[model samples]
Target: MIKCCNYDRKYPMAWDREDFSRAYRRLAPVYDHGLLLYELVGMRLRRYRREAVAGLHLQPGDTVVDLGCGTGVNLPLLLGAVGPTGRIIGVDLSPEMLEQAQRKIDAEDWCNVELVASDMVDYVFPPHVDAVLATLALATIPDYDSVIRTIASALPPGGRLANFEMTWPEAWPDWLVKLGAKLQQPFGVTTDLKDRKPARSIQRHFARCDSSERYFGAISFCIAIRQAGTGVNV
Candidate 1:
């Protein structure tokens, strides 16, 4: 059965972390199944994940953080990239989501995976993290610019950040973009979809930023590397 929590408020103009936590608390169990349907329907969202992660170009023994790592779907790829000696810290706002992710770690006997339950804004990132990744998660963060700034500060110079998020292409009709936003509302996506360009925000903090759009311009992926001598004031 598909279970979901109550969200009586109107769709938010930006990320309401509390509401998203509540919604995902119930949605966690069936989240993977829902993604399967999304993929079958031609979204092929997992491809975006794979592409973004590959861009990180991770090495064995490196430590990586999977920001907003819902249900640990990227753990396998991360573990593969980093090898058994590497570590992965998966952070999410929902405890239920982390619970599911923990199960995946246990099932795979991955001794290096760590799951933390906290909002991205307040979470304490560890030092020496080689890369950070967020897939289909940044758009849900109301203060994504702040979050990007935090990530930039936490990483060492040349550290990588990869993100895959929703986007509305200029070529797409107004009606289609509206329809896309409407379809995403049930999943706690921000109502202001047109204004959430995560790639641009990421570029402000990084020296090198590479971005691409996929799924007919409905999705955008960005990989940025922190530059030397830049520090976040916050």
Candidate 2:
């Protein structure tokens, strides 16, 4: 049941097959240690948060949701950007990750973040959100269509969704990106989804979308805006 579009075993909050549950369960204990390398290298976490906020043009009162918001690396940056008037929601599938996220939120004394444990593919969202951002998380969900629809449905017309994911860049040499991604696959990160299916799916569901690639094609982001005049009454 666990096959990468390419990669698992089961535990609490595992959203996919039995393998995923087991893999995530094993990962939970050392996930932070494994991720520390990324944090140290090029300050990837900080950069992703910076890029996510900049892409969204976030405002003081806007509401934002971070799907698959593991350990809440982006929450502090987001809280600063949105300020006291705005709200932030962090949704994740792992209870252990959410515990880490809550610790980060408390350490920063942020009062506006609400972290929920849920699967990104089928989670129900509030009626309106100004923006949705997920970093290094979207490529994990193979059911891209349902995930995109859920994100789209959560936004009001004119709202935005910006996602930063590991992707292989079409413009760059593919071999290098693939090799780097392969090295990282064991830690629950991969670039296979970023190729065409994820990109095409976004364009099909959204009126306008764009992306920026960084880190020698190791990181990429997609930004989409809901049409303001859709008349769907978000």
Candidate 1 lDDT by residue in tens digits, 1-234: 322222333333564776787788778999999788778869988888888889999999999999999899999999989999999999999999899999998887999999988889898888799999999888777688989888988899888999988777768765665566666655765446566788888888777889888888888889998867665333
lDDT by residue for model 2 (42-122), tens: 747566678777888789988999988887878877887788999999988877778888887888788999999887876
TM-score of every model? 0.90, 0.80
Question: What is candidate 1's CA lDDT for residue 191?
Answer: 40
Model 1 — which ten-residue stretch has the worst lDDT?
A: 1-10
Q: Give candidate 1's whole-model lDDT.
A: 0.82
Task: Report the number of backbone clashes for model 1.
Answer: 0
> In model 2, what are the clashing residue pairs, if there are any?
4-7, 8-19, 9-19, 9-21, 9-22, 10-21, 10-22, 11-21
Per-residue lDDT, model 2, residue 230, is: 64
Best by TM-score: 1
Give the runs in model 2 whose Cα sits over 4 Å from its true position: 1-18, 29-33, 39-45, 170-182, 190-196, 230-234
Candidate 1, superposed: residue stretches over 4 Å from native? 1-12, 228-234
Angstrom error of the Cα, residue 78, model 1: value is: 0.1
Candidate achieving the largest lDDT: 1
